[model samples]
Target: MSTELTSREVCQHLRDAALGVRPLQVIGTGTGQVSVDIEGWRLQLEFDGKHLHHCGHCCCPDGREWALDSRQRFGTDPVSLLSTWELAQIEGLLRRAE
Candidate 1:
């Protein structure tokens, strides 16, 4: 079996981590790319030496998925695949991505 996280799984993982249900570990930092990991999958979340950006989907009104790229834009449909309130929920959950 495979332990690797699918894109959807990674999205959900980020959601969970944002909500505090899962742990989001900051493994490395380079101002431009802050390395973070959940379970096993790792991605460099964009950091401007202090805070993280792109906290949600790109299309939503309040979505901020422009900050980070797992490999490409909209890599996770977190806000894109959700309803109005759900979109807001994710936006809030990942705002303080630590």
Candidate 2:
């Protein structure tokens, strides 16, 4: 497998990490949330019918959160939003994860 991951692939990696040995959980019909711990930082992302929201708690100022709409922010492209968010928050930690 390649070290670099697309946004969708990164999301999958997070899902795998979060679900390790735990009872499978679904956020909604199609929406889901995933949080992964890398080093001392926790990265989190959530997607729903309309938007994809992400937070980099460690890197944010005063623990503030950020969210982006799939349509307005990424032109209805989820990969763009997620990938961009991942890079912004953890500086490519998701791609580096196993």
Candidate 3:
């Protein structure tokens, strides 16, 4: 079963998994993109009001390697395509990185 989550929920999870004590920093308030930094690794999420644009990237520890990140987005509503478990898994990555 698929469960869609709200934008607030997504942001909350990201904030909770942030590396430092402070909350996740909002990068582009006018561009529909938000990102968090953890030990030089930046995790970004973008939404086009209806779809979660999974065109984010991450900087590898090597500092010279960059990888395209992936997140599932397959529904209507504002960034509501990701399921609960899927979101958790994403958050887990951040936690592990920290």
Per-candidate count of clashing residue pairs (backbone under 3 Å): 1, 0, 0
Segments of candidate 1 deviating more than 4 angstroms: 1-6, 49-51, 54-98
Please give, for residues 1-98, the per-residue lDDT of candidate 1 as tens digits. 54333446545656666566777666766646566665654555545644344333222122222323467566353334444454454445434554
User: Is 1 or 3 the stronger prediction by TM-score?
Assistant: 1
Quote the positional error of residue 54 for candidate 2 in Å: 7.8
How close is every model to the real structure, measured as TM-score?
0.47, 0.25, 0.35
**Per-residue lDDT of 1-98 in model 2, one digit per residue for the tens?**
44322344334434443434222222223235545443322345443323445532221223333333344444332234344444343323332331
> lDDT (CA) for every model shown?
0.48, 0.37, 0.43
- Arrange candidates by lDDT, highest first: which order? 1, 3, 2
Give me candidate 1's TM-score against the actual structure. Answer: 0.47
Q: List the residue pairs that clash in candidate 1.
A: 54-64
Instruction: Give the top-scoring candidate (TM-score).
Output: 1
lDDT of 1 at 18: 56
Error of 2 at 40 (Å): 4.9
lDDT of 1 at 30: 60
